[model samples]
Target: MLSLFLFQISLNRMIKTLSATNYSIEIGPLTESSFQDLLTNKYAHSRKVIMVDENTHDNCLEFLLTAFDDLTDAEVILLPAGEENKVMEVCFQVWNALSDYGIGRNDLVINLGGGVVTDMGGFIAAVFKRGVDFVNIPTSLLGMVDASIGGKTGIDLGAFKNQLGVFKDPVAIFIDPSFLHSLPENEVWNGFAEILKHSLIADSSLWAKIKNYRNIDDLYTADLIEAGISIKLKTLLNDPFEKGERKLLNFGHTIGHAIEGCMLETDSPVSHGHAVAIGLLLESQLSNNRGILSNEEFKEIEETIKALYSPIELDEEQIAIVLELMKNDKKNSEGKIKGILIHSIGHCTFDEVFEEEEIRKIL
Candidate 1:
């Protein structure tokens, strides 16, 4: 009986892997009318609630309320905005709000802000009553291209980032570029880091296109957004469970998360995508040093990234501290500091492990 059960579980995983590739990713306008279109889809229930932040509530909720106005009943739960709020405490607040609303497995949760709202909101939905359905209506460029599409949901645990979470995808996602019009310049740059990372991993052509996005408005185009989205979707389809191929997506994330976490300890806080971009540069150099990528390829990546991002000037002490944090990344196994590195501009993955002694030397 045990053998048969294990076999069934293996078969189920295989089926899910296959199905993810077959799934067609949808990208279009996210408006009041889109909600009506979503209502036509098959689901367990129509009762849905949105979890948003202060800025999103002010800029988007009023307009969104009208979108769901015709539904039997829909509500919004607003939280404070910014990365500081992505904690267990905020997760509890959202869970309490959902409980008060009498939300159930049949109901759905909609994440309506940037990475913070989506990450925390998705975590709440994943744990509420064991598990519940949710949707992602990402308002920020970062969320639309990366966070909103991936099912990895979690809240930060103290100095560590995304230390607690589960892989739970939403029922659907709505990507509307119009919402990005109000985004700050830094935030737009933060999102671009992921776009660049996506390009570095699989699509050289996409990388070429991204290099041409000189200004923020360049990212607002549907073609650019769709290209970035397609790169991620294709990767996810190949490695939905993140056991192998999908790990490549973390090209800059390993050190990037650590740097962001370390910086948060001080007065300055680095956005997730920005930190990852830095990670990509440093790690790419490391890859070159290891005889992986050619010098020319490494320089091209560094030059392009530097064009958009000004590197953080860190002292030896700061670099050392951040490298220590990388040891605790959730992706590592048994405390081994495994990370994704590049063989070339368009090829990267998590096949390399950095030694603590060498890491210390680099810092």
Candidate 2:
């Protein structure tokens, strides 16, 4: 399910924490009664850096700054928003600012924005001064459910998605759903794609809830958000480095990332979630072709996705381009693209290799 909580404060909905391999994900409001005091007391004397994009700086940062007095003296580094800005050049600029601010290993780096901010901010903290403690306050649903949870920090290389990255868990992850208010309607649905991905790969119950909702407003609850995080975290803790089962999470990402890369220079680029939605359709069809998923289940998956996401018709030329981009996917090994094939809506197999010809046939 594309589970989301409403913007209004729910007094009865107590704060929830989801455990990861090392760090804990806190889903709740920023208040003195919650985990706020623990954070303030822990880093009261340490130098702090709050990394944000323009959107979060203007919208979410104030709420955080107001709630935590420990960050009163923290430096704010604002970068231009969007995936295009997540690059080496921006990292260099942020590195220079950190140097100028006299930040050191003991200081904390708080990433405060969407996926781009969390991905790149975590990377900066990992590389600077050989490694530093940092926390994530993901302001977007994408960051909250997937990007900010896995400890996989990355930045795009040229048009490729997450081509350069490091595996470094943040000190903690605080997800305050109130930040969703700053997002446009499209951006919110973009995150919905990941939730959909999680549901298809592991949680049939979530999928059952997801397929029933024709409107985004129908799904709003924090516990469902925790369920999505728990699904990803369980697989990640078992395989932190993607040596095995973690590949299950990459179900739609293989082709989805290629589509994202191919559209990078286009007049209109597709969002990550939309791109993944397309990949899900293609891969599930392949599962049926390979005699894994049942045709009945495949039709259900297709109908549910088509109801929410418009089909992105790719031309022969565009298909050729994405095919080439898929060749560069990190999961590819032995000169074949790697993908996860599903047995059904909630179960999948990992490290299923496909020859270029087989993948081409599907395209």
Candidate 3:
């Protein structure tokens, strides 16, 4: 009886290993010993390439080099930093660089920066030579919990957000919290918005934990990252293609993305998290106006985000442009704008359409 039971347990473990190949998210420091084995055994024959922005190259590249001795021969491709550079032109440069270097189907691309690097690098690898293997080493807090977990990869189309892209999962994702040490304080705050979004949409317990935190600095830890990542991974497992449950993840992105697009057009641009913080407030107000979210909950959500992020005041003209951009969002259908609104904390409804006039009133 004991032998039979052990056999069943082993069989289940093998089944799980076989089934989990499509997606993975690993959180830990990248040390020389573990990484060397990964390179020697798993990626032995594959050519290696590491993609980074100027910022990451300056701040984070040495850590990777020290971790993997084999990377001495890996080609390094550096793109410009900032959301403004997350465009087709930059992608074109990366693609050209790959072609010039003769990168093949078996070669691996390592995305080693924040959201922009991961998003663009994943998109590049997804299409390069008809999809090559890639891994994400997320350097920013936003990247660690949010961008690196989701298979969504794309470059912005003009002033719009993620207008061109594909769903391509990396073979593995390595999240090293040490990367956050090099980021500025505002960048850390930028990531907290997504964490708050995760909490708002799925975990009320996480929301309670985050709301009490005095500052972004206090929120940086493996447990916090795991909380946000668990929400995202669980959501994606249910709706990998964003056909239903995954849409809930866009809680603040509707207006947030529109605002981001508008800001990208101006000389002064807000970070993705900054724009999302604003979206959280506006959308929460929309939820309140629609009689879904309670008055007290709305106030709490508004004040929490406001305390973390300074207000971004937009003129009427900018509001109009943002509203127009919403029409082009991938979530919309049949000429109606779709939004995800919370009925209460930790619960949300998606595919909720609102009229242009209704949205205008809120702005």
Candidate 4:
């Protein structure tokens, strides 16, 4: 009976491989047996470094250490938690640490935290010794579904988000849903917004399934997570560098990132998902005004987002400041503000230039 049950557990695990231009993303369980296999077969002789944030260091690091006996000698690097610490100074600290420890190009880095840790650690690995191999073990829903798969790695420039970065794919991505068990409710919701964005841009069926869920908890299944990952992987397969369809994935990020940046300056910091939820509503309004998205669809999208997130009251002054930040967005070209606007659910258009006066009116 025990052998049969263990076999059933193995059969139930969902594994998917997404191939990028240069590398692949493997999503599945990170069990002790599986991790031990990875260590013994892949990195038996290579030096290992594991990067974690304060939160993950406290909560999730033990699970990783106990997964494989080979990891006993791996160096541990702890970073300060949160988006505020994702800066060049942190990268400098990481680089300096790698240098002091003599982490060579053949060494491996295992990023074992949320988006902030993965982003910073991946950047450090990409630059140190002219690029070392790294693996991502995402602990947050946001990182697991969005940040971990994409090859884009970077740090913020001042108040700007992801202003400096590179395209460096991880050697492997091990997504163990067990990590999500330790995440706060807000952190879960923070990643759900990206899933929502993926549905809105590509899968009407996913959008329908998501709209019926009364709360965030209902969306935590492995199938739902894989659906979100599939949409992003398909987009990346077509345009890895955001030259066309890939930009569709940025549907709510333009205005959302601006709001997030502004909020970071205030005492009340907003999560990435919260700001994107607001951006979805505002951008949907623009779509409706442009006659691209119907009023009925717009109402449904607005009400659904409003139910999930509270309205953020932004005055004219705040709107003006956000607009200034949007102008600095990397998506812009030839001094024109580019946006991704929806035509309908699961249908979006990217690189749409909007006049300043027109945008101000929508805000």
Model 4 spans > 4 angstroms off: 1-22, 32-34
Q: Model 2 reaches what TM-score against the true structure?
A: 0.93
- Candidate 3: C-alpha lDDT: 0.84
Tens digit of per-residue lDDT, candidate 2, span 136-205: 9898888888999878998999878898989888888888877887788778877888888899998898
Q: TM-scores, in order shown?
A: 0.89, 0.93, 0.93, 0.93
The pairs that clash in candidate 3 are: none
Worst 10 residues of 3 by lDDT: 1-10
User: 1 or 4: which has the higher TM-score?
Assistant: 4
State which candidate, 2 or 3, has the greater lDDT.
3
By lDDT, is 3 or 4 better? 3
Once superposed on the true structure, which residue ranges of model 2 sit more than 4 Å away at CA?
A: 1-13, 32-35
| Residue-wise C-alpha lDDT for candidate 1, range 1-363, written one tens digit per residue | 000101111232211111132222345555422345566564425677878899898887776776554443677788888777788888887788888888888877878899888888988999999988777778888998898876889888887998889888776677777788877778888898898999999998888767757777788875666667777777776567788888998888888888888887678888888888888888887888888999988888888888888778777888777877888887789668988889877888685788777666554
> What lDDT does each candidate get?
0.77, 0.83, 0.84, 0.83
User: RMSD of candidate 3 to the true fold?
Assistant: 5.2
